[model samples]
Target: MKLPLSADPPAFEIRYGITEEAARRKGYEIRKRTAPPDPSPLDALLKKMSPEAVKKWGETLGGPGGKEAPNVSVTMPNGDEVGAPTTGCDAEARTALWGSVEHWLLGQRFGSDFREGLISRAEKDPAMRALNVEWSQCMAAKSFADLESPAKAMDLAASFYEKGDETTAFTREVDLAIADAQCENDTDYVRKRRILEDRYLAAGMGGYETEIAATRELNRGALVRARTLLAS
Candidate 1:
C-alpha cells in the first residue's frame, strides 16, 4: 500500500494558473513587494495555545501530557497567561468545527456524498470496471503490465518512492502518470465515470434533503462566527 504524491488528478484540458511566459515576471514582482500581510486574529488565538502547537497538534509525543498537551504560553499586557496551539492543531480544530459544511453542501447539491462514497461508487461501477479492463490492455501495450486499474497503476508508481533515489522515483512516477492519463483519454474513462456517477447520485438523493437544509442553516451561522473571530 503506497501513498500517492498528489491526492487528486489535475482537471482535464484546463490551465488556470500563471502561464509559463508570465510566471517569471509575476513571480519576481510579487517577491519585491515590501508590505507584509496583516496578522490574522485567528493566528494570534492559536499562538496562545501551545509550543508549535499549531504544527504538531495531532502528533503523539510521549509524556504525561501526551501530544495534545499545551507546551507554549502567551502572556497578555494585563498579566494573563494563555496556552497557544500549533498550526496543525488550529487547522484540525477548524476543520472539526466546520468540515460538515462542505459535506452537507455536496450531498444536497450532487445527491451523493462527494468524498468517500463517490470514489467507492466509481470504483465499483460496472462501466468503470469494463473501462479499467480496456485501460489495462492499453497499459500492457505501452510496456506497463500487471496493472488492473488506474488506481492500481498509481499505487504501483507510488511504491517506487519507498526505495531508490527520490529523483529516480519521481521520474518513474511521471512515466506512469503520463501513460495512465493517455490510457484514460483513449478509453473515454472520464466520460463513462461521469455518466455513472450522475446516475448513482440521482438514485440516492432522497435521504439527503432534510440534512442538507439543516446543514445549510448551521453553516451560515458558522461562517458568521468564523468571520467575527478572524476579524477580532
Candidate 2:
C-alpha cells in the first residue's frame, strides 16, 4: 500500500491544517482532563472529606456500595464501555478477580493450552474473535523470532517494513502470517522455503523480530546518548 504523505510536501502545508479549530479543541480537552490531580470519585470524596472524619473513619471503611457496589462505570471521551470499578471491590483486588473469571470461563470452552483453545473458541464468539486476533499477533511474533531464511525474512521485513517502525511485526503480522501460511505446506514432504531454513530447522523463526531489532537499536542509541550526556 502507498503511504499517505508524499516523500516531500510543501512548506506551507506543514504550517496550516484543515481543521485548526478541531485540533485546538482536542488539545484543550486533553489539557483539561489531565489538569485534575486525581479524577476518581473515591479520590474526590477523600479530598473533600473533613480531616476529623478521615481520622475517625480510616480510608476504605467500606462505602455504601459494599460487595454489591454498582459498577463504577466511567464515560471515556470515546463512547466505549471500558473498565470502571465495580461496587464493593478495591480497584486492584476486585479488578484482578475479573481476569480470573474470564480465564475460567475461557477454559471451560477452550482449554489451558493458549492458542489451541483460544483459536478454537474464538471461532464461535465475537469476544473470542478479538482474543483470536491477539493470538494471531502473538503467534506471528513467535514465528518471526525463529526466522531461518534471509529470503523469507526479507519478504516479511518488506511486507511489514512497508510501514517502517522500530520493532518486530512492525506494521503487520508478516512473520506470524507467513508461518501460518507455510505451516501446513511445510508439514507435508517438505520443500525448504528459504536458503537458511535448514541450518536453524530446530531454532525456528518468529514474526516480531523486526520490531524487536528496531526497539533494540533505539535503546542502544538512547543508551549511548545517555552515557555521553552523563560523561559530559
Candidate 3:
C-alpha cells in the first residue's frame, strides 16, 4: 500500500545530535549534584552514638571510634518522592534548570502532526485513491496482501512489542520495513503521494508559512540558550 506522506525522516532528525549532546550534559549535571560522596565506616558509626559517650569511649579505646556514612536519601527540589543518594538529581529540577534548551529541542520536532494532516487530505484525492489501489496490488504480489496501507504496516511493526523475544521481533520488523520501502518504490506510490502532498501544501502556503516560521524561531532561540549552557 501507499506509504504515509510523512514516512521519511523528520526535519528535526538532522539536528538530533544537539538533543543528544544536551541530554548527556544534563545527565552529567544531575549525577554530579545528587550522587553523594562515599563516607568512612567510623564516621557512620559515630553519628548514631551520643557525642559525649563516643568521645569518652574513644579515649578508652585509644582513638576516634566512628566514621561518616553516605546519606540515605536526598529530597528533591520539586517535592517529588526522595531519590536515593546514588541516583541522579530530580527530573523536575533538571527540567526547570534547563527549560530553554529543552523547549528548543521540542520545537524542532513539531511538524509531524501537520504533515500527517496533509497526508490525510492527499489520500482523499481521486488520483491518490487509484494510486493506492495499484500500490495494494503491488504489495499483494510481494506476499503482503493483508497490509492495505503503509500506516497499517507500521502498526503491525509496532505490534511486535507485545510478545516474542525482543531481538527476534526487531529482526522481523527490519524485514517488514525493508519490504515496505521496496514495494513503495517499485509501485511509484511514494512519488505520487509526494506530488499530491506538495500540491496540497502549496495550495495553503500562507498558514503553513506562519506556523513553520514560528516554530523555526522557537528552535533558534532555544538553540542559542542550549549553546550558551553547553559552553559554560
Segments in model 1 whose C-alpha atoms lie over 4 Å from true places:
1-114, 228-232
| Worst lDDT 10-window in candidate 1 | 1-10
Scored by lDDT, model 1 comes in at 0.52
lDDT of 2 at 24: 26
lDDT of each: 0.52, 0.34, 0.51
**Model 3: residue 50 alpha-carbon error in angstroms:** 28
Report the C-alpha displacement of residue 102, candidate 2, in angstroms: 11
Off by over 4 Å in 2: 1-21, 24-30, 37-232
Q: TM-score per candidate, in order?
A: 0.52, 0.17, 0.44
User: What is the C-alpha lDDT profile of model 3 across 1-232, one tens digit per residue?
Assistant: 1111111224421100112233323311222323578888976887788867666554443322223312223221122222211112222323334353233223534455455556567779998778777767776777778776666655676676578886666666556555666666676776677788798767655556865776677756656765777899
lDDT of 1 by residue, 1-232 (tens): 1111111112332111222233322321222223366799965776687665644433422112335643444332223333323233343444444554233232223222232354566568777788778989998999899898776765676677678986676677667666767777788777776677677655544545665565566667667767877888
RMSD of each: 13.3, 24.6, 17.6
Per-residue lDDT value at 187 in model 3: 67
**Candidate 3: residue pairs that collide:** 42-66, 42-67, 43-66, 43-67, 43-68, 44-67, 44-68
Summarize candidate 2's per-residue lDDT along 1-232 as a digit string, tens digits: 1111111111221111113233323311223322557578966776787776654344233223324543333222122222332322233332343233222222121211222222233234554334334434543555455443222333444455345563543324333334444432333212322212233322221433453354345445545655766788
Candidate order by decreasing TM-score: 1, 3, 2
